[model samples]
Target: MSTEGSVSNDREGHVKTEGERSFWGRLANWGLYQTLMTVITLSPRRQFFILAAFPILWLLTQHLGPMLQMLRVSLLDAYPVAPDVAQEFSLESYFKFFGDPIFWMPLFRTLIFAAVFTLCTLLITYPVAYFLARHVSRKNQMLLLLILLIPFWVGEIVRTYAIMILLGNTGALNLALKWLGLIDRPIPFMYTSFSMGLGMVYLTALYMLLPLYSALEKLPKSYNEAAADLGAGAWSRFRKITLPLTIEGISSGSTLVFLISTGFYATPVLLGGPSTTVFAETIAGFFHVAGDEWPTGAAFAVIMFIVALLITGVFQRLMKSLRKGESS
Candidate 1:
């Protein structure tokens, strides 16, 4: 009788354990389902805010956070300070940039180079974008774009290296010219302003191309057709209709390319000679040193950033006025 009683007790204990597990599992599921229903019942604006929380967090932490830290560092007298030393804030870092004239050439050159390169990119890519948007069948456009984007799939360093190989003395262009008897010797294409400019244009071409293509594609073909029907020539149609309408694309592409060109370090380093050194390299030189020079680099970076922004701001104003004039 005792043996049978113990067996019945074991069965009851097993059933009780299962009941406890089921109770907790149901509770967990209920809580989760209730939370989801609450979220679903939220207003659309609240839902949007919930969805946007991650991206806003990323922008704050990843983008704004680093810039703020850099600004703070720029104001400091030194970084990586002695463990017990107090921090000193000063403007001497900023003064160094103003006081030293050696940095002037690279700074000005970077601005000029960025502007020229951005314009060249615009001119070069505009035709290609126009053809892609206006001439090509819609079905093949994505395929063509994918083909064009193949070169950009690689990292910037790899692309810069490819440029180096292509522009080297005995590279394909030189060899082809030699084979054609066009030149007696290979021209030195590497380590020059021309090489740097070529690389900049190549790197920034996509930025210009996509915006122009978007603007061109979204443009109503009817506008140009109507102009043509009214006895407008091709150039006239483009000038009066296409160009005016596409000003936003030009502005956006130019701004993106100019800003990107100003900050390029790898392509310029690889393709540029001493005479072609840009402000970025100069700023990097400061950080490369062992000691308090880091603040100076940070300071110059801030200066370059501010100057670039001012130039773009002026460009934006001009573009906006042009847009207004075109619209009027």
Candidate 2:
């Protein structure tokens, strides 16, 4: 009887073990997850390609696809051609931009605004980035960065409205000035170039700050210390050592801010008066008109894109040369 009971107990233990294995095995072998696991285990290169496929496809479909479509439309005489009508392509849309002088001022204005705003953003954020990277403790650095980022978490429109509220006649700034007896009446800060510029700088500050901070953080403290030991003053060390080292960050941040500033429509419209209309606002006007005007808008957009790229290319070459000079 004892022998029989021991044999039965062994059989029961084997069944339980098999049951647990079967349950886990089913989960591991489920559908696409199993296929992915198999590829990952068998071929690392194949695994990488599989992982990268989605983003590559998304870029092709979402970004490149739209640009190509826009380019095609820009060459056409008219978009949304009737079923009975033959699709005719021409350079008229593009010609419209070059032939007219009315469009010139806004384009020039946009470029100038973008350049100024980019510089302002860089100047303002550099000190903050330096302080955070050099003075703040490592344990609390992330917390401070998070606090800075919280404002950007909201939509651009919301943030623009917040700026509107702050700069309006009866807003915080004016009220504060009045309270301090600096002015008897509220300053008309709204719908002006200053207000628009202020909004642009506020919006693009993060783009400049993060790159500067990243570059500053990766920089070795020993270099600054060594320079100081050699009797270099703070300004001398910063001008010679710190500035040269972080040129790449400055270029990256400036480029991003400039590109973003050129494309702003809503903020400029809301904050700017008639004199401050940007090329983006002009481009938007074309789109807001009849469908026939879409091709014109597309053409103008392409012109702006090409011009911006040309400017950016020149800027990048300058930055590259500067980097080479620093390294040498």
Candidate 3:
């Protein structure tokens, strides 16, 4: 009788345990279902955001996924993993790059030229942008902006090529020079660093000009007039009023010019002499032309990106300091 009772007790215990597990499982499923229903009942704005984010997320994945894949390939020992070489992660390529003066010299040269180009553009475009913003009538402003945009409508390659022809040995400028008896020879204008710098500025000057115009155009005219009425000289009024207000334009224009000048490769290649070596072109050669050197190229790219980030950060800090000084 006791044995039979114990057997019945065991069966009851098993049934109770099974029932508890079933109840918990149903509870978990109900919680998940409730969460789904709550999401369905979200506010219209929240629902719209959720829906809107899906496409953006998809696009990000599409781009970032490939970039991640490329980054992985760059980190790998070789393109094919080199089964016999015992593959492992290494910074050997970067080490090799940093160890050479050829790499360092070109990089410094590029930075210097890019700085000079940005400075020149800022100086050259500022007057035009200022005139457009302050002095020009509205009708003229519209007409002038349209004219300024004309060069951008034309392709960079075509513009650069046109420049090449104009600066070529037998091109229009040389012919004009010969006609004027300005020089005896064609003037060796075709392949030179000066040509490279000129092309870079010509192609990218609009970027700086437009930003300055945008910032300066929105200023309240009364502020400058008010300052002038208080006996502030024209230069003082400009230094104290116009400049502080248009700081954003200066930052934007400088940054745009700097970024473009640094990243430019084709212009440098087309217009530059053999001695003019920008790191962007060097990076391209390692990836596209050099044999089995893509890893080195990738390393170079990573370094350039970091360097650009650092430089931009420094510029931002400087701009902020200037802004603070003006505010005080």
Stretch of 10 with least lDDT, candidate 2: 18-27
Task: Record all residue pairs in model 3 with backbone atoms less than 3 Å apart, i.e. clashing.
Answer: none
Off by over 4 Å in 3: 1-53, 83-87
**What lDDT tens digits, residue by residue, belong to model 3 across residues 1-328?**
9978866765675587753345434454587876975786588887778878989898788977776765665675566555577767777777877899888777888888888999899999999999999999999998998998998888888889988998999989999999999998898787788888788889999999999999999999999899888999999999998898888889988988898888988888899987888989888888776456877777777777678768877997899789889979
Q: Per-candidate TM vs. native?
A: 0.85, 0.85, 0.81
lDDT of 3 at 7: 60
Count of clashing residue pairs in every prediction: 0, 0, 0
Worst window of 10 by summed lDDT in candidate 3: 19-28
Would you list the C-alpha lDDT of every candidate in the order shown? 0.90, 0.90, 0.83
Q: Cα lDDT of model 3 overall?
A: 0.83
Candidate 1 stretches with Cα past 4 Å from truth are: 1-28, 31-58
Reference-based TM-score, model 2: 0.85
Task: For residues 156-182, write the lDDT of model 2, one tens digit per residue.
Answer: 788899999999999999999999999
Worst 10 residues of 1 by lDDT: 19-28
**Candidate with the greatest TM-score versus the true structure:** 2
